[model samples]
Target chain A: MSVDQFLQYLISGITQGSIYALVALGFTIIYAVTRVINFAQGEFVMLGGMLSFLLISSFGIPLIPSLILAVLFTAIIGAIIYLLAIRTAKKASVVSLIIITIGVSIFIRGFTREFLGVDSVRPPFFTGDESLTIFGALIRPQALWIIGTTIVVTIILHLFLSRTMMGNALKASAISTRAAAMVGIDSRVMALTAFVIAAVIGSIGGAVMAPLVLTSYNVGVMLGLKGFVSASIGGFKSPIISVIGGITIGVIESLAVGINWGPFTSSYKDAIAIVALLIILLIRSGRLALEERAD
Target chain B: MFGFVKNKWIYFLVGALLAVMVLIPFDWFMGKYNTLLIFIGLNTMVTVGLCLLMGYTGQVSLGQAAYYGIGAYISAILSKTYGVNPWLAMLIAAIVTGAFAYGIGYLIFRLKGNYLAMATLGLGLIIWILFRQLSEITGGPDGMGGIPYLSIGGFGFYTTFKRYYLVWFFCLALLLISQNIVRSRTGRALRAIHGSEDAAESIGINVAQFKVKIFALSAVFASIAGSLFVHHLRFVSPQPFGFLASVKLVVMAVIGGLASIWGAIFGAATTNILSDELLLGFGELDTIVYGLILMLVMIFMPQGLFVKLKEIIVQWRSKTTQKV
Candidate 1:
């Protein structure tokens, strides 16, 4: 591909990568605190986008307030999910937990389809839809908005974790739930906080990217999978690394489609992340096995 | 007579079960539900394998539908396009799916728990994508049809009655074989690994090899079911082999009491009845119900519905005898 085309793909990749980064961040926080992968993490994103649209169009609320309400509502749902489903399961095996989260995902998808309908919807862009020339490549203003929001969120999350007593308690619980509890930190509360934080980040991503990518009930399946891939890229440990992983995945995918050589067409675009997931999993299986054994 | 019955009641129960199995599909019997029974049989074949993997071996596979799709597509393509005997095509599908599972199992068995689930899930999605994208070979989303029925000599499994018997035959055989496996030395090793992988490894169980072998065996069962499904329906489609179908299979395995081989039959039958019969009018509400069933069952009785019910029955029986 030419330099301009490369730059164009790069810009678009970064924009999409920011969304994946937000989703990965969500996964990381939840996995860290609760040791559950939270397969329904992507549904929070879907909820954000779909709820924002409902608030704006059905309730006749303005865009900014609708987005905020959507995020808050999604956060509440996340808390309920933890209390109702995840926490209720006493001494659940890993297999049981996985199936439960999958059930949550399926339930959310079906609920949305029944109530909101299956058709894809896109909220109006934050600014203008017009593309601006940057280094001989075109970039949409919305793309910039997404990337800027990601940076701000990351910085604030970093500060929250480092500076706040609640955040430190969350971090301590992630390190060792038993130890955290011994230190008088409520591990259950930490898990709830983790879910809420994950929801906030996922919803922010969903609301921000809704205009760029159409929002729908079933969109969570793919987005969740991709976010999982991104988080797995960082061993689902560090938020910073997962953010970088998300961007790398986005760039590779964009370039794959942009090049359009052989089986790299858009038809096989979804396969790219999954294939990456398998490859990375195979490569890291030994280390991951050790980690599991350590646990 | 009562003393004789107590000594030989097991045989009597087995004889009665065999009779019921044989008589159920007759015209005067429950022939109207023959189609549903056949589907339950097909699903039981797959779920039994899943039971062996999850219940016995303590491994989770969320990509069984990939094997199912592979078996169906291979049988469909070979029998229809190449004019191969349907029986031979089915055998080939089983072998190929077995090898594919072996290869994937070798790579993925290293990861434990949730990561393994994710890897298998990714594999299923990739295979589903292939089924959709390779339109020329697999007929893509429109699906391929006109596959021939399985035949022996001149007789063919063309009618629903014939298909039901054929499917149940395969299903029962697999269930029996699975039961034997559970009773054998290999079953002990699998249970040992499930109980504690490290302890199993220390006991010279060769954990990885056993896991890979069981995973391949499960995949083979799923493939055989797929072959049967394609021939029975005379069609192959990518839609049925997606991620949701894989989840459905796990749901069946869980509901049937993952550790109990016979429970596979009940799991498959109950799920099919719920979805295909009772929930037909509810549309998307069925999905919500499925989700609820999975969550509630896992939370309350991870040992599974069938196993818990059996436990409760046994407890009640003991209580009644003591009162007597």
Candidate 2:
């Protein structure tokens, strides 16, 4: 590929990767705290996009307020999902937890489809729908928004995690709930905070990327799977690692499609990333098993 | 002879139930729902295998429909495109699916719990994609049709009634086999592993091998169900083998009380009847209902409907007897 084309793909990949990174960050936080995969994490993103779109287009609300409302609403839903579903299922096996999260995901999808209809919708862009030339490669304004939001979220999350007492308590509980409890940190509250944070991040991603990618009720299925793939790429242990992993997957996927050689067509883009994930998983299986057993 | 009959009341009950099952399709009122019954039987076949794997062996597979798809595609291609005998095609499909699962399980069973679920989910999606993308072989998303039905000699399972009996025959046979396996020494070892893999290893059980073998066995069951499904419908589509279908299978397994062999029938029948009959008019409400059922069941009664109901009935019986 030519340098311009390569840069174009790279830019597009990073833009897409930003969304995946946000979703992966959600997965990382929840998994870190609760040890549950929370298959419905992607639904938070869907809710954010759809809620903002509905508020702006259908309800005739302005963009900025609608985005704030959407994110807040999604965060509330995330809290409800934890308090009503996850917490109530006390002492559930891993298999049961997975099934329950899947149940929540299906419920969210079905509820959205019933109420909002299945047509894919896109909210208007934050600034305008104009492409800017960046070093011979064109980048959409919304793409920049997505990338910028990811960077800002990453930096803020890093700061919050390191420079805050509450964040330290959350991390402490994740390390060992018993130890954290002995030090007066309620693990349940930490888990709820993690869910809320995950929701906020996921919703921010959805609202920002909605203009670039259409939002729909069923979008969560693929988005959730891809986010999980991204998180798994980082062994689901660290948020920063998940961010890098997400970008790597996005770049590989975009480049694979851009190459347009043999089976690396656009149609097989999803498969390429998944195939990569499977390979990585296989390589890391021994370590993953040991780590899980240690838990 | 009368005393022997009284002494073997459980055997008499089994005989009566079997007779009722066989006669259901012949009855005028019940015969109308033969298609539903056939679907329930087919699902029960898959759920039973899943029950053995998840309920007994303590492994979760969220991608069972991949095996189901493999079986359907293999049998569909063989019988329709290649003009192979339908029975031979089914046997080949089951064997191939079992082998495929054996290979996957060997690699996949290394990861426990949630990771295993993710790997299987990914596998299922990849297989679904292949079914949609392999236009030359799988007929792509539009799917392949016109597969021949299974037959013995010249008699074919041409009607819903005939296929109903055929499906239940396989379903019940597998169910019995699963029940027998659950009662055997191998079942004990599986329970041991389920309780604690490390402990099972310390006790000299071949945990990995057993898990892989059972995984293959469950895949074969799903394959058989797929074979039966395609032959009955005379069509194969990629849609039914997607992630949703795998979740539905898990629902059936969970509803049936994962380890309870007999509960497979109850679970499959309840879910099929609910979706196909009772909740059809509600349209999208079925999804919400299913989601509710899954969550509520897992939360309130993870022992499953059958086992919980049995517990309640037993407790009631004891109370009544005490009062008497």
TM-score for each predicted model, relative to the true structure: 0.97, 0.97
Model 1 docking tier (incorrect/acceptable/medium/high): high
DockQ of each: 0.81, 0.74
Best by DockQ: 1
Residue-by-residue lDDT tens digits, candidate 2, A116-185: 9989998998999889998999999999999999999999999999899999998998889899999999
Q: Model 1 over residues A1-295: C-alpha lDDT tens digits?
A: 8999999999998998888899999999999999998989889999999999888878889999999999999999999989999999847989899989999988888898889888899888989799999999989888999999999999999999989999899899989999999989998899999999999999999999998888999889788888999999899899899999999888888889998988898899889988888888888888998887777
Off by over 4 Å in 2: B1-9
lDDT of each: 0.91, 0.91
Which run of 10 residues does model 2 chain A get worst, by summed lDDT? A269-278
lDDT, candidate 2, B90-139, per-residue tens: 99999999999999999888888888888888888888888998889889
Clashing pairs in 1: none
**Deviation from native of the Cα of residue A226 in model 1, angstroms:** 1.2
- Kindly list the per-residue Cα lDDT of model 1 for residues B1-324, writing each as its tens digit: 866866697788889999999999998999999989999999999999999999988889888889989998999999999999999999999999999999989989988898899889989999999999999989999999999999999999989999988999999999999999999999999999999998999989999999999999999999999999999999888988998899889889989988999999999999899889998877677778778888988999999999999999879988997999
